[model samples]
Target chain A: MTIEIIIQAIISGLLMGFIYALIAAGLSLIFGLMGIVNFAHGEHLMLSMFSSFWLWTLLGLDPIISIPITMLILAISGILTHYLLIRYILKAKMIVQICATFGLSVFLRSLAQFLWTPDFRNVGNPLLEGRLEIAGIFIGQPQFYASLVCLLSFLLLYLFVNKSETGLALQATAQDRKAAETLGINSNKMFALGWALGLSCVSIAGTMMSNFFFIFPDVGVHFALFAFVAVALGGFGSIIGCLIAGIIIGLVESLGGLLIDPSYKLLYVFLIYLIVVIYRPQGLFGR
Target chain B: MNNNLQKAKLEPVWHTNKFIFALIFFLVTLFFFFPFINPSNFQLHLMIMIFMYAVMAQSWNVIAGFSGQISLGHVIFFGIGGYTSSFFYVEYGITPWIGIFIGILFSSLVAIAIGIPMLRLTGHYFAIATLLIGFSFQIIFQRWDLIGAASGLWIPLNWDNPWLTLQFHESKIPYYYIFLIFFLLSYFSIWIIYRSKIGFKLRAIRDDPQAASSLGIPVAKYKIIAFVISAIIMSPMGSLFAQYILVIEPERMFDIEISIIVLLIAVMGGVGNVWGPLIGTIILIPLSEYTRIFFGGTGGSVDLIIYGILIMLICIFRPSGLISFFPKKILERKKFL
Candidate 1:
């Protein structure tokens, strides 16, 4: 009711917004790169969370400290996915393309469940803990650090995408695969790089989330759905659009939950995508 | 060049000769007496499952395969069929037979509303939009308490007049026969469409809407028609499934997994053909059912893993689906073919 509570909500929403943007980054990148939705994108998130959790458990490393290792692990899996599954289906029917990834999603989720039961596991006592209150606005330390890391990663990714030569070639390939190939760019390598880069984004997001979110085989499912909405609202392949849309979603979720019913919070997030679909099928920022 | 290609596409269907008709009749007759032999209850259950899924997949084919717009959220109509029927039946004491019609009507209206806008978007956009809509429905139905909320709805056990209520406690045979009839009717409808101009026009849109529109086809009208047909096929089955199981949960009914399974059956068995869904269900259902029966007790998800792999392998190796494995000579029209 008061301005202080609304301010608190905005601050908290902003922090979670960064994480959501980070979570959506990889999905947007892959879709922009190859036009494949990566139905298993959520499973990749689940895997990265598990990887970070296990790293913490077995190696006695803090989730933050093991971010690089988890990113590496996820990047390799991404490379493997590109080589083993995606490349073959890239030119196939739409249904084939959809099913191949959908199957991979189902396969990976169950495999994770089979290997490490579906029971939720938490990273207890991560290096980040406690809450900070500044000017009557409360922020959890873990959420703050998570947002800070996500923002930093997004900036780094932006640089790599825009400033780097390989990134430009990647963009060229995404614009037109055959044209890029004619220009001596190996579309295959670009695709592989896209996968590695995409999964790495998921890994970073997952590692950050591991500090606060429960680690489970199905944990990524929720994030994956949210990422879909973010990608759609932001326009596929638009990084800035993703960030803005993610923030909007985060604010709407928090405000909707506060002003209305909590259980129906997700309804508002999805409604935004529906609105985007009807009014701007090209997405809010899509060309 | 285009004319020849069009001829080629149209010539493959319409093989309705006496022998083929007799063969189909013989096979249907054989299947009709199948339950009379008193097969094991498990086998009967499997057949029923196959018929149910076959019909669903074929229904989905009207939109996805023929029109070439994949709706990953096809389960929404199924959920609509189920929730509407069960709510009326469980609360108002309305018979499911009438409820089924209402469910069908609801789904058709929903299809018209959703299809007009969504069908305009092509390929991935359509798929993604439908998927989000489907998820939204799940969330809505899960929270709506009038239909039992998340706990789901169940028809009180009323075996007194099972026939009227669409619930038969006497045997699984009645369900099997009913489902078989549904399957045959659905197949017949699809078969009729397959030989009709609407089928050709749909496939034309599937290949290229621009080209179809250039030919003066009412692209918009046919697309919505396809969507409505698909919804109509899927809706009643949901009601029947609810009646058979005597339970209707929003989560189970609206799960994306159901959509995936239906797509798998249609795609792996050969889409763009009348027999594709039946072939897909016959192969997929039993494998999944058996795997779950044997290896799923510990919640291992072994069946799902296998199911996933099978779909991937089939999609990669046989993207045209298993029906293509048959001799092309036999599939084509003219002579015995």
Candidate 2:
């Protein structure tokens, strides 16, 4: 491959990586706060994409314009999920917790199929609908805008987790639930907030990608698999680690597809995941 | 000394209970043959499916339930078995009965190879790694043209000689009886293992690996052994599945859904018990079949929805599984009597 082509692949991969980071951030946050791996995390993303698709098709609202509504819906659903299912299994065995979330994932996917008919739908005549050329490199406008949104959301979440009082409370609860409760932080509320914030990040990603990618009930499976690898590669509870790992996965996928057959793209991503898990299970940025 | 005296007094009662249990089991086995006496093809097909799933679930229970290693990627063994047997039969004209043994050996070896490295990780890491391995295997099989790639391999239908090919021309009875034997063999082996010294060590590892190791238990060795045995038992069902369906594809054979179904069946019936998967198969296969037959747009959606709800409820309210309820109730009734 030419240097220019390599650079192009790198840029695209980086952009896709940002979106992947957004998708994985919620999963990492949930694991960090509650120590529960939300297998339904991908289903939440699928739901948000469907919401965006529906809003665009029915009201002629641009996907960009429906971001807040989609986020609000998903955030509420996340909170409901916490209260309805997750809270009950907080003290349960590890396998029980895992199966509960897995069951929820199955329920959500089938429910989506029942409601939406499993047809792949994409937003038509999206607001950002062209390609941009920057000094001999080409980029899709939708992808660029999606990456921009990803960066902004990541920064906002980082600031929220690191700079705010509520964020501090969430972290305290995650560190030691009983200690946080003793300090009158209401750990339950903090957990609910974690779910809200985590799912909102997924919502933004789903909305942004709705413009370019096909939306379907099972659309989240591949992305969810990638996000799991990213979360693991980044370490279980580290947000920055997830972002970096997500980008790395994206780059590997794009470069691997370019260098080798596209069919082996997932092979490269999984190889990196296995290597990281074996050598550095704590992740790149994890403490 | 008093406890030993009481145990000796109760020995005859325990022996009689054992005899009764065995008699009941024999009767149940006889009952299964009733369907064969005057079988409809559809009913026989469903029976085969139930038996196939029961074998798969029982194998899964060995690792996940007995050893407490929650592997979510067991479909890889199933796929390996299907692929191996089909390849042997298609290429060398080997009988599926013989081919299945080779498939079992192949799957067992792969399980040991994968288990050695994977068993090093604990809990969720092990689960996720196995899942990724399964996905990678599916992707590789999909891309490899030598194994038929995405189009998959098909076992040609030869009606001339049925027994040699392990194919019956018009009688689903043969398939049912074959799978019934598979189920019995799987259950009997697990039953023996559950009562053995190795089974005690496996349960010890499951309950507390650190304590087990402190007690001189070979924790890793036993776990790998359980995993390999589970994989070996799982492969034959895959082989039977291929012969029954007359085709095998990467997507269908290595699908994550198959893994989830097996897991659910084991969990729903009662994990760690020999009868758990059998009970689970009995309850689930019929429910799923009826739901699919009656409610028809894509068929699987409604059944999956119900299954999902049932699983969540079971996990939350009855984590010990439905079978636990029965034994307790039976014990209570006996006490009252």
Candidate 3:
């Protein structure tokens, strides 16, 4: 109710929103271009988190530095996933694609559980341990750094997509694969690039989350649902829409939790999702 | 009606079938009632759990399998039923039997409202929408202190007075039989619907909604109707399960996991095919129970991995589900396929 409390909530919401946007941007891009809802999208993020945790524990690397490593690894993993599994379902029905990806999600989650033993692991990053005090509001140093990283990533992504040839091809494929093929673009390569880029987004978000958030096998399910809600809120397939929607949802969660229990935060956001889908199936920013 | 008679005659004979559903049913029923035939309390408890699961799966199959909506929030209806019956039982001493009807009514009404909005969404959106509604219901239930909130409410476990709304005796055999009857009735109701005109509309919509709509079928109306009818059957499932478990917690009644299990079974069995869920339950339920027994708490999602693999195989190889495993001659002869 007070200005300080509101300011603190807004700060928290904006930071969380950036993280949501970072993770969801890839999902939006892949879904837009491929018309496949990658249920394993969050699993990619989970893998990054685990990798970051291990890197931190073993080599004493900061999560921020581990970000690039995770992104590169995930990019390769994403391409391989598409080449091996998702490529076959490109021409198949949407339900088939959905189930295929959902299967991959389960498989990846099980693999993580088998490997990690379901223990919560943290990235040992000293930078992440610091906090900032601004006008009576305390914000974690890692979160602020993550926010800056998210903004920079978004800007860099925007440039790559808008100013680069491969990005143009990816956009063209997303707009219409058949048309993009007519332009002598290798649509498969474009799809692979899109997939890799999507995973990179997940990697960055995962690294950011691992700094503070505990890494677990099923964490992807939680974030994936929230990302879906964000995508739905923003209008599916719209990057700008996802950005806006992610912020709105982040505010909704942080502020709504003040009125109700935190456990019901997702439930309330889902209600918004239902209402949005019911009223505008195309989403707020979807075309 | 004419087609109904033809389909009725097309029922696969128990002897001709390799699965022997009738024998299995009888054996399972007898096993559940074996305690009553002799008298053992612990074995009877397991029977009650099995019966509850059987009925729960049946209710889920109606919408997820029959209507092909693929809802992941069926536990919402179960929660509605449980809370409705529990609230009335505790406050007014109303028998849960009567309270069950009120539960069904409330559940159906809410389902229609949600369905009316969600039926527009296809595939994953529909699934997510239902999940949201289920989650919302859980939140509301947990927050409303009248229903005991997070602490949960305990219904009196009286045995002697059978006339009371909810009670249990020395033996759990009667509960098992009662659930068996409910399961049979649920199966029969779905069967009848499958053979009915409405069932045809539902299947047509599931196969191809645009084509069905083009053929003058009221697609939206039928989908909502299917949800309503499914809720009517499923709500009582909650009441029965709550009574059997001797308690109803919000999370247990409206668990997201329950919805996933239901969808997983239906998808594994061969969605849109009658007896698919039953067959799936027969195969997978026992395996799951065994996993629980073997690994205890250690086995987090080993079974889920198996189920996920099965779903992938089915979606890739045989989207028609286990029903495709039946012999060609039987499928051709029945013509009910």
TM-score of chain A of 2: 0.98
DockQ in order: 0.75, 0.74, 0.52
Residue pairs clashing, model 2 = none
Candidate 2, A223-268: lDDT as tens digits: 8888889999998999998889889999999999998888799889
After TM-score superposition, what is the CA distance of residue A130 in candidate 3 from its true location, in Å? 2.2
Put down candidate 1 lDDT per residue, B1-337, tens digits, no spaces: 6875566556655444667788888989988999988899999999999999999999888898899988888999889998888889888999989998999999999999998877888877788788788888999999888888899998888968888888998789999998999889989888877667898799898999999999999998999999999999899889989988888898898987788788878987888878878888889899888988887577648877887888888888898889888788777653332
| Candidate 3 lDDT tens digits, B42-117 | 5455555555565566666667665667676788888888888887887888899898999999999988888887
Ranking by DockQ: 1, 2, 3
Off by over 4 Å in 1: B1-15, B334-337
DockQ, model 1, C-alpha based: 0.75
**Model 2 ranges off by over 4 Å:** B1-16, B19-27, B329-337
In order, what lDDT does every prediction score? Answer: 0.88, 0.88, 0.78
Worst 10 residues of 3 chain A by lDDT: A119-128
TM-score winner, 2 or 3: 2
